[model samples]
Target chain A: MKLKSTAALIGSIIGASLLAATPAHAQNVKIGLLSGITGPIAAMAPPMIAASQLAVAHVNEQGGIGKGGKLEVVVGDSACNPQNATDAATKAVNIDRAVGIVGPACSGAVLAAANSVAVPAGALLITASGTSPQITSINDKDLVFRTVPSDDYQGRALARTLKGRDITKVAVAFLNNDYGKGLAEAFKAEFESLGGTIAGYSGHEGSKASYRSDLAELAKGGADTLVIFDYGDGTGLTILRQALENNFFKTFIGADGMKSDAVIRELGADNLGTFFTSSPVGEASSSLESFNKAFTAAGQSPDAIFTTTSYDAAFLMALAIEKAGGDNAKLAESLRAVSSAPGEPIMAGEWAKAKKLIAEGKDIDYKGAAGDHEFDKNGDVPGTYAFFKVSGGTYESLGEMK
Target chain B: MELIGLANYAIFMGILIGIYALLALGLNIQWGLTGLFNAGIAGFFAVGAYASAIITSPHVAGRVGGFELPIVVGWMGAIVFAGLIAWPIGKVCLRFRSDYLAIATIGVAEIIRLVIKSEDWLTGSSRGITGIPRPFGELDYVASQLAYLGLVIAAVAVVYFLLERQLKSPWGRMMRAIRDNEAAAAAMGKQIEARRLQAFIFGAAVMGLAGALFVHFNRSITPEAIDPMIATFLIWIMLILGGSGNNRGAILGAIVIWLLWSVSEMITDRLPTDVALQAKYIRIFVVGLALQLVLRFRPEGILPEEQARQTAR
Candidate 1:
């Protein structure tokens, strides 16, 4: 009894001290910048984080949220692991008091954060890169939104891209995750529906040392092309190398995750001749051009998958916060107002003008750098596709997927 | 206002520590008492998680188990399934030395990971099973978090009590004897292999229970829920640092290590973006260094194993 009482007393003191430690800072509206900074896709984090920071910096320079109140971003590393992502989301929302989150990056991490943290905490989360169709049905009450189109759109685009090349038969090897599974399933369905036969399909676990067996089996299906859905930094390289060693595959079709300089460097430009990749493209707009310029001017690459989308995610969340007058309860509703149509058009880097329009109590359509977003009730964006093929040691845009 | 948030964070941390404590206790039973190094705690944990998830989640197209049974039933299924899986593995590996068991257990874990990843119909095909009904999950945010904390605390207390009782029993003494001196204990008519197998399966069942607790708390389970090596090593360190034979030590080590890891992360998170980017590696280095320091100085652990008064010889 004595020990228990002592524990209770200590706990109360700790709680009281914790409560006292936080003095209110109403001038800064905290936003969470979350991404997988230390896992399979860690390579993708530096630029994405920079993009978010650039958005915040740009917002601050544009007279901030409202009446000189700044937007402060708290960075959280999701690590691309579900549990870690959940924990990171919780900390960013609860401890750091972030009113909104700009990312959780990967579909799996975003899913974990959305269901486990964002929804429960009532914090608005705008994922910059999550493209899994599974995210389309996460039950987040519109709190979870993404700048990228789901794989449902990417799959159709991939099907069309492959068919245009007269490649009708394909074997598929996908990393086991929401992004991989959703893209693979969507691609298979669209490809089959388009009269192309799926020669084989294998969903392999990621981070494995090798995928020789699965690749060999996929090879035996007699498909001329191997369509792989996986992040370039993880098992995708190993799988391709193993298949090459076994002479299992040469021709390749890949999704957005494979549109990386790392994949080209690792697989060699010589071997990429027969390779083609399709990813969601931002509609060509002056906003996109400016964002690309600003991003590169900050000494970061703007060409990586999702870099522009991440910048737009941060920019949109800040706009929402500003429009809501820093009230988190109204932030979600304000997000829809800012990103959807039926408003005065506002381009990226026009935060000062957007602030003026919001002050006039007029709805402003944020034509973001990534695209013109008109969020559905489920917070999904309309998708456009960019087809690219390896050329001159890098991926050169072939054409739009239409 | 910030105090409430901190309290909620504490509760979340407490809940995770409690679940990890269950795993640590399981490891204590296996390695601390029986001299068996079951390196596949993550595998057994996954079995429990996937089993419970399969049992309790709402039915989806192309997947098994729309039963949507009560959470208790799911937990029971988790324990039973994890125990049964461990039973076969233990039967095959308990006859060998600990190194062989380690290798076999890791293999089992890898295989289990593959099954969870590849078997889409069974485990929801990498999107994983979601919408798991969390008890008291419907309550308001603070209330819900508190209720879950209460549930986790209760589970840990029950596990701790039962295991403590089991530890002081005759079977516990016999198991310790076998662990300390296998030849002498074998000569004394204690069927060592069978007993080891029993402990192994029982420990794995506990780990499965931990998985159930975790899945229910998150209200979802994915193939990537647990980092196999990092989680397994953390639990191993907890058991080693807290003193293997002591139940209290196991729980203590869990809470301490988890707190340290998370607290360090929170501190590093406050750094500037550029500095914080490099802080994650520093956090890992600190954890690694702490473990080494603990091993070098207090190899027997914070609370060293209490030596039994009676000698088998």
Candidate 2:
């Protein structure tokens, strides 16, 4: 009797799922908005999703996809882990029939989803926040791309900028995660190649009560400048506070992850006179201004982490879909055509103009709110960056880093 | 959706169910048959995944070998290595009672996770090892998925039949005796500690094989993939809700739970955008609710274990 009821229950669930799988409006083109909606980065996902939706809104408002087809997004919760990531990607590709997928957020999720589901199914993937250097090495058949720069580029850029400022020797303390480790390795390589000395280098696990012992060891190397590659609100704050109280390092450096207001709010800008951080920045352009105005009007903070990139990834997908004429096989090529150079510039929210250009068989280049998005051979962007210092309870950009 | 698309989705689900069914079977050997409460399924799963990944993946800098061996060798290595690691853990931890054993195993799993996260030379640290080749991966999408599904079904069948045979044997009776009453089993001269250790190691090996299949199917392995919520607790839920003591129940649990997990999103996607985004969290809640309802109403699970009756010969 129990087995019979259980069978009936399973049968109902399958039946309901089949009913749910029926196709929606035929004139709507679907794209997958895969994000870490429920896991480690849950706090950041809502704004990012809002930003992507904002892009879809711009597309539909401006004129939608080709031949009056409405651009629709199917959101999937990747949960910031590979198991859910792959499952979400599979459903997005096979069930929703999304021609392109915009994200899985975290680096590991991106790798798993792209390799297992998107790449195999010939769906184009553009991650907004997956920054690990390993992504550049995926055998993705040119179908995988990211709006955000890899940690490698930022690390190397920071190293070069620091050398330009005449700081040759530094002690590095990085959090032991993919983000911190990738940046540290890249920074170390670039700094050493430029004849700079890494007086001390160490990776520490996060959330420890005190890092004084680790600070003491790093101070023994005699480098006055301490470079941290971790989140400002987390271990990086603890490390900085300990180093300041102990007088372990005279000057400090941080990467993009460290450019947080939490550092200023916690450590106080008065004591951080010698602290500086390198962060990615959209080049001073009308593209960023337009996105900011539109996103703020949508009631979301334009400065939210990855919001711009998230917006850009979705907008680029829309353009690619338009260019590809809904053909899955040509999405990769269409993405490159719409986002790269040798075409008329299409700023964010100019979907109508871009759609007309594509329809007219004219080339178009997407100047994204995050960056120009002129993808290299590996579908990676050599991101623009700027060095910043804390001032008046906020970050003040010094100037662009070459 | 087109029939081909539905077929592809079903194939993908089947592959995942097969992998998870193996995990449930492994848990059954330890917790069901041997009456050991092992909460560190993620540790053994990670061990198998990384071992197979390091063995089969091509060589990369700053990490252990991509010996580039045959895929089968990698799968075998995963099983052997997972069992080997389980041996030491079971020896030290099996002495603890059920609850204590659970605590100890969770700690062990956390330790294993940290080691994998920190050890760059062996496991590539947090960036993880990629480029592990998938069998039949070169074929077109549908063909590749179909082939992999076939492979997974074969693996589950072999493991299922072997476990069934083992369950009906004298060893199975001894295990049941020890589980029901250790003192009584010992009075009958059963080796409780050694047999428990054997069960623990055997279960871990099966878990390792599942991990290998998972890593190969994904063509990559990352620390994120071994998250306790998905890799460990989810499998536990499947086993408990399916029927811990019944092998067929374990497979059914995998099928039902995974389908609910994957299908719930499709249903929710039909909602308005804001509601749909919020509705995603409901799927997680639904999973927990199903477990709660099952535990409340059907304590022995959907298919209760069959009693072995003594009849006239």
Candidate 3:
């Protein structure tokens, strides 16, 4: 009679603990998302997070991963800082037991988090927007991967695109961080290798106000062409605005930082004609055009921004998880098998279609909402860069580097 | 209670308690013994941190012999530099009331961060100073981390001993007299400015030593690594809670607060999914609430120091 009572008590305890739960979060496969929701980079990050949320909703609607399992993404705000990012990473890794991590938009935050913790613990950590060369170079771990190509490759592509143009010598301005330095060094190396001259390479802190004082120095450059390897808008946006106010330089060439609508909106179309190079996003590819229409139909805009990249990042991770049979440890191994390769068919912004291919055991390639989601051994795609020119008050692609 | 390796657990407790003990003692010298309130402990910590970082960063140009320096020299240089920075800042702001001093010191701390972030020549900016070789290169990474933690504790013991000895000396007597009544000490012709300056500088130097120790133990340092919240308020909380102006109190405060914080965090982390989201914020709230209650109930602290007590006994 005592043993019967004890068994009943144990059964009740298990039922109360598991069955009394009111939420679906317990059974869900959790993914961690860290973002700069309210920091200096929030303008670039907020929509990316929103887009990632949309992707998660869409994935869950299709019965989530592993047929019956749920998919839920937990988020942490980094405020674009190292300590804050580490704290977020720790919470996600230690507490959430996230199978994968999706963001931390800037290189500064990513640098503090990428290795040491998640990769060693068998979690797949991927970055959507951060493009510093060091992010990939500092690792031999397969768990650490990125969707965007490093600025090193982008810098090289920008130099090559300008090689046949009228520009002979170029002055460069860079933000003072890994993204800026690596890009500046690569651009200089690529340009000089092809007999081009660098008038000057100057750097400034990213989040600062007023660049006029500094821009005044670089404005009277001997080189007519100016390559800006710096973030255009932030605390430091004041600098570029001040330079434009003073009419410092006319022929402006920019890195991915300049590709944002926020930058164009700040500088205006009258300041267009000056070109900036960035990823081939929202370029109206047949595949991408269809994606934009569907994304808009689903109440999301498939724009060429961090949002699109983050969305694709989420989708790819889910696909990788499915391909690896829902094992987080094996998801990273399947990534190389799925990355964009020449001659392999590209799966662009169509996961529903890729789902069929994933089942058929075909060499499935993924083209994301951002662009062709290819990755080098270093976990970067090094894809074609679109040379955008501002014409008639909007940025239009003049050509692209493939 | 039945967890294996009781020996390892004791060692862990011993090392963490010791390292934090040094941190508290260093702050004790500044705020406890000397009456100079600095909310910028993190700045000096960062300074000593970057100094060793600048000397040792493999990515940095013109490194000493292209390798990290001997850990002893690195730690010593860091401590001395920490003190040197503090001495001047104290001289400039020490004349003001506690709140004003805090404001100025906080501003100084912000400036330290801005400089570290902008000046890539010194601190490596956003990429941060990485690949800092371990103190004992022969040990593996985890072992090295734990071993370095042990070294910091041992270092704190030496500091604690010296501090205990100094507290019994004439210098310490003068410090207390000034702390009790600055004007009275001045009237007694105790060279008030010189005495305060000496203590401030010495305390800052010790704070810097803690910073260097932290970097080597972690094998990394970032401008953001030494946060004001941790370096500034954590010290204040520990010192106040443990009973300020007492060595034993300071050590006890560090261990107690850190233990509660870690354990509470672990518990909150394992909570059910929906509540897990709120658990972190709840944990912070609990810590804050407990501290408030402690202050209200035991304003004199759990182990209050006897005022105007005999010198050594």
Candidate 4:
């Protein structure tokens, strides 16, 4: 008797979910906005979602999708883990019938969602912040793409920028996680290949109180510059503080992970005169400027970590959907056609113009807010990066990295 | 098209439910039948996942595997490796009373997670292992999903029937006796330590198999997938809610909890866009609330253990 009642309740819940799965407006073109809205990177998710929503708003406000159809977005919380990510992706693909999916944010989430749901279902996936080099090797059949450059690109670019500035020798300390390890390895390879010397290189676990011993060990190599590849708000702060207090290194360098406002807030801008970091920036500044203005007007900070890439991903998804004419099978090809070169250039937020161009059967190239997203064969972007230094309580760009 | 989509979604949910059911059944063996509090399900799960992934995946340049064995061999490897890893942990920590065992197991799980996160060559570190082969992965999306679901259901049925048979035998009665009163069982000439160790290893090996199933289904394994919250605590909730000592109840609990966790998002997605995003957070709260209500009202669980004498009658 008890079991019967429980079964009835489960039946009703499943039934209700089925009822809710039906689309309200059948003509509306749906897209899935998958993000880590509730887990490890919860704080970063809201802005990224908002940025994607902004792109949808631009599409709907300016003629929407094909044949007077509205562009609709179904937001799914990936929760920054594979369990939630695959679940979310399944629902987005099967229930919402999204033509394309914008993100699952984290690298691990991206892999699981793409492999288990999106790729198998033949749905297009464009993640904004999945930066793992491993993603470059997914036998995806051209269905998986990301707006953010892989960590490999940034590390190599930073290495080149450092070498260009005549920094011949340096010591490195990295956090023992995927982000830090990936950047450190790529930087080591590029820097060494460029005939630069890495005097000392070590990876440390995060949140240790004192790195004085590790710093001393690194300083034993007698290098002045120390390149740190960890989050600025995390153990990187501790390492930087210890290095400065002991005068272990005269110069300090960081990857994008270390370019946090928390560092300046805690360590003070005055003390960071010799500190420098390299971060991905828009190749064409106008594209970034337009996104910044629109995002700011929408009451969101355009400078939030992956906001630019998030916008680009959503906008590019919209362009592809338009180009494909709602045919799900052609989204992958359409995405490449719309994002790659050999056509009229489309800037961020110029949805109506791109739509018109697509209608006229002309090819279009999207100059994204994060970079010109000319996807390589692996659907990976070789991102444009800029060097920055702390000045006047904020980071000021020192020019584009070669 | 709509019906087909629903079928696809249902198949996906069914596959996940089957995986969680296996985990819950494994938990039932330890906590229900054997009176152990092994809080580190994620550790065993990770061991199983990485073991299977390495055994079956094509050799990468850096990692410690190029075995490229058959899928069945990978599953067998997962079971063996998980049991092998559990033997030492159980020998060391099974002596602790329930809560202490829980604490020790939690620490063990954390250590395992950190190792998987940091060890690059062994488990691909945080980048994770991809390119795992699925049994029917080359089929069309619907056919492949249906085939995987069928595979999962078959595995569940096999585990379920085996567990049911084991729980009905003399060994099952002895385990229950030891669980209800350790002192009395020890007085009766039962080797309490060895029995508990055996149950722990058995439960962990089952969890490891579930991990293998999960990795192959998803075609990838990451440290994130082995997070204690989802991989460990979620299984515990299913076992406790389904009635820890009841194998059928364990399966039921997995179905109930997973449906609630997943379907709640779909229901909430119908709300206005802004509220829908905030409502996503409520799904966690809803799961927590269900557990609390169950604990307060149905502490013995939805399908409480049937008394042995009553069952015999």
Candidate 5:
């Protein structure tokens, strides 16, 4: 009885606060954004949220998504917790009345909220950062779409590169979280299936500052090619690189988590031959460079690996909506219409032509900053992977991970 | 902008203080009344939420114990579950040293959390349970929040007053005696363990009640919602700052902290968009600094507990 009365009181108070805004909100087309604004994945997510909002802003400036004259974004902060993700997604879709969700960056977060809310509601979930293969493999609902490729895709690409190098065995270590575990499992499955052997496999806690003990155990396995599946940050990768200084191993392999300039900066030139596979960041032109310059001018770290990819995901999503006569359902159907090869060139520069082609009833392909993303069955982009080798201060494309 | 009025400010602060009051009252019973130190208060609070959620959830196995029962009955179930669970935990840990009890309880907290996370059948694994029918969602969100705040504040005040009254009676004296020296109090023909158990169970029940309230207000529940960082630390901070054993102090500290948090968010919201974006990092720094400053400046907290004194005959 006490709780019911208290709830009754809270309801009245909140009603009074929101009564003023209802009329204003009724006019806008709301897009629900579920992102990890705090906790473990916050480092990668906040910027993505900003870029997404910017995308909404740009689209609104050009023209609204559908019949709505303006686009409004309703952001739900999941804080990288699965439970919060579930609640936030419901509130976003049901209460906030948002048409689609462009978030839930963490793989576990995506899984938590996707099944009951987004998929059931028939609202599209376009994740900008999650890379777990289980996401796409869960089912064929088609409502769940990802801008990033699965860990399986990236892992296989890396394993193929190992094949090119004639590497037979590698000692692998990964963070125990969903992202790390997914990549490690994929790398192991693909690498071993191709007649390769894992010399060692161990999981490490990412919160710790020292991984010397974990590395020492991996080192004892005596594998020359060390595969690091963890987010090789200042703490973990520093220990790995120091292991080389201590003569533990010469070359190291990294999955997408370690594929960053930060990793290169941490390891230095001595660990220069280190290879990692991530989604291909397509060739940068003067236009892209200018965008980078503008990003930095606006007081953001322009060189962060995900910023460009996030920017591209927005454009691609909007382009799809545009091509589908600006309907979410039509855009979802037209997602397959976005091809990479042998069809119309729908690169970022050719948006005007693609727009014309869409009007002309032609199949419009979408190639954005993340590369020519021809989504295969299950929304997994069958895009080529780029292998980055740290040389000097920057990453030189060694070759395709394939 | 100033005309926005501080009604929400007052309302939000009042409710949060009410919640802290609830938590602090429970902790007071365990620590102040019974002399049992439970470091894992958050764990039980989480359990209470999950229990109520699993019972009332329309989605979980079709809400078997569900029925979307009125919030009061669901809350009663939660409190009873919390009390029952506390009985066993207190039995095993109550006889040990205070420090040992703390460690054991913390372990229990962790075990509960892992169970909640992995147990797909009950807690829905990591997917969590959503679409909870808020007690009066017929009124919608904003109305619901206000209703919750009012409900929580009244509950806290009533609980605190009742607790104060009970403590002032023969029962209160027995608790104080047990708190000061358990052996002496026991030698005085007091059933020390029974008294302690009574206090402990009562506290856990209150925590259970609080959890149900929070779960319904949020209109969702998940295993991950049991984060001890917020639940545990915040409770400890409230008790310590508000002066443990003082219900009023606890209530004050809760409201003050909630106000600080909400006001900071509002301030951050009003900042220039570009700077506001970058201010996210700065916000964490500022919160940390505030905590440190509060601890340093007011070690006894804002409202110190009024010590009991016996009149000279």
Candidate 6:
């Protein structure tokens, strides 16, 4: 009797698992939405996912992908870690059978998932906002792509921003992670190449109770300005406060990671007068304006940095599927075909027009809501960075970097 | 193709379970037999990982690696270095109770994390040391994953064999005796501190070896690879669930916990985006609840330690 019961239990579990493994999507084109759902970048994920959903809704409303099949997005939480992201990506591929994966936002997670899951499964991966220079070096057979430009561009832009301000000497402290270290190195190289001196530079581990000693060390180098390359969460704020208390550097500069309203609110506009930051500059296009208006009207703010980019990635993925006639295998080739030049310029929010053009067998260059996206061989798009200054407790754009 | 994907997933999960089983085995030596509390398994793991990565990876211009030693030698170096790092802490803390050892280990793990993060030359700072040599990394996805799984399983088997033998040996009995009664063991003229230190170091060496296997399998190690607290806690629960003083239980527990973890992820991924986002925390809560159920109902664990018996085979 006991043996029969054990056998029954095992059989039931196998049956249930097999049932779960089989996806029930009979007439829907499935795309995977992978992102940092519950890690350090958790705050950024909700808006991005919401924006992607908006894109999906818009695509479905416009008669769905190829012959009336609704596009369904399978969401996977990456938590910005390699192992978890790999597992998530694999589940999306093997079970959900996603044709393309939209994100696994952290650089390390992207590298891991791209190599282990997406490339092997022959699925196209387009990360919405992972900006590590190391990601450009992954041998992923062109299966991996990112909508955002890598840190190599951002670092150069930041250095040029500093040099243009005539700041010749600076100290740099960055959070130790792919994003932080890569940006810091790029900035240092660019700054030094532009005839500026790096008085002192160091990488600091985040979530520490105090960085006073490290801050003191950087302060001792006596650089006129301090460049902080880190996320705007508590860590960056703490460091900034400590530096302020110590009266370390006269000027403080930060990159996209530190461009947060929380920083402005915490530090206050008066005290943040000497502070400046740079973020990926979104170009003014009709697509962007429409996306902003629609996004806001849906009771969601479009102010979040990657909201437009996430929408564009989803929009592009859907358009690629449509162009491929709902073939998952051909999605990769179609992704490049639609996003590159020598085609009809399909503006964002013009899904109906794109569908019409795709059906007519004409190539389409998708000018994204984020901006003009012409991908290089490495799947990176060149972009501009805008400088922002705290003005009356809000960021005011100074100008765009050349 | 679907079956192949499932096979790949199983192989990948199997490799992780093997690596985690090695960690559990190490903890069994420390907490199960020797009555030591180690709260810094991830620290030792990072040390072993970075040591192997530095030794085996090709030299880059700004980083410390480039020697590109043989993979086997790097693995051995990882074990030796991890043991060496554990020696001083064990020596200092073995004089006190297990709580002190736990506290010291936690501090050491944090310091190791800091070093890995801040020391850009030694570890590639945030763009961590990548391209670590894997034994069968060049193989096709399924074949490579299968080969790596085999390697990890072999490592786990070796560790298990050594640990089981040690547990049945005279030294193992003496260590347990000291753990159960320090005053009595000291009175019996057994050098309690030396034995405890030895067990701690050896167990830590096993964890380091696990780390080496882990990095090689992944082809890289980043500071974010393991959450020190959650990972450490998970192993603790695994050891306790599988029965601490039993070698077979450790491996079984590792597999069981990992399967539970991954299976829960599979279930959560099927939920809608909004609910799926919230479900990860729920899964963690479920794991906690399962632990409570195990502790309340079967405190000795699923595979309780087999008491040493006098009857001959």
Candidate No. with top TM-score: 4
Docking class of 1: medium
How high is the DockQ of candidate 1? 0.52
Model 6 agreement with the true structure over A253-283: per-residue lDDT tens digits: 9998788777877878899989999987657
> What's the CA RMSD for each of the models?
3.5, 4.5, 6.2, 4.2, 7.8, 4.1
Task: Return the TM-score for each candidate structure.
Answer: 0.93, 0.93, 0.79, 0.94, 0.69, 0.91
- List the candidate 2 regions with Cα displacement exceeding 4 Å: A1-26, A207-217, A241-248, B308-313
lDDT tens digits by residue: candidate 6, B1-313:
4555577778878888998999999999999889899999988888888899899998888889898999998899899989999998787766767688788788888888878877778988667777677897777767877888888888888888888889889998898889888899999999987898999999899989988987887676777776674458888989998888888888988988888877897787668766777887766677788788889998878887776322212
DockQ of each: 0.52, 0.48, 0.20, 0.47, 0.10, 0.43
Candidate with maximal DockQ: 1
**Global lDDT of each candidate:** 0.85, 0.91, 0.69, 0.92, 0.67, 0.83
Candidates sorted on DockQ, descending: 1, 2, 4, 6, 3, 5
Clashing pairs in 2: none
Interface RMSD of 1: 2.9
True contacts kept of 5: 0.05
Model 2, position A257: C-alpha lDDT score: 74
Candidate 6: residue A111 lDDT (0-100): 73
Residues A1-402 of candidate 1: C-alpha lDDT, one tens digit per residue:
999999999898878877765535547789888888887678888888898899899999989977767888888878877667877777888898888888898777787788767888899999998886677878787798989888788887888778888989999998777788888988889899889989999888767887888988998889978999987666777777777778787788888888877888888988778778887666746888889889889998777778888888999999999988857799889999998888998887888999999999998999888888888878999787788899988888888896
- Report the lDDT tens digits of candidate 5 across residue range A300-366: 7655645666666666666666666645566567666754455576654344566567667877666
Q: On residues B18-97, what C-alpha lDDT tens digit does candidate 1 reach at each position? A: 99999999999999889998999999999998899899989899998899999999999999999999999999878778
Chain B TM-score (model 2 vs. true structure): 0.97
Q: Please write out the lDDT profile of model 3 over residues B14-84, one tens digit for every residue.
A: 55456566777887887888877878877887888777655665654622324456777777778877888
> What lDDT is obtained when candidate 2 is compared to the true structure?
0.91
Off by over 4 Å in 3: A1-27, A192-197, A206-209, A222-225, A271-287, A290-305, A340-349, B1-25, B54-65, B69-77, B84-111, B118-121, B134-173, B187-191, B213-218, B226-313
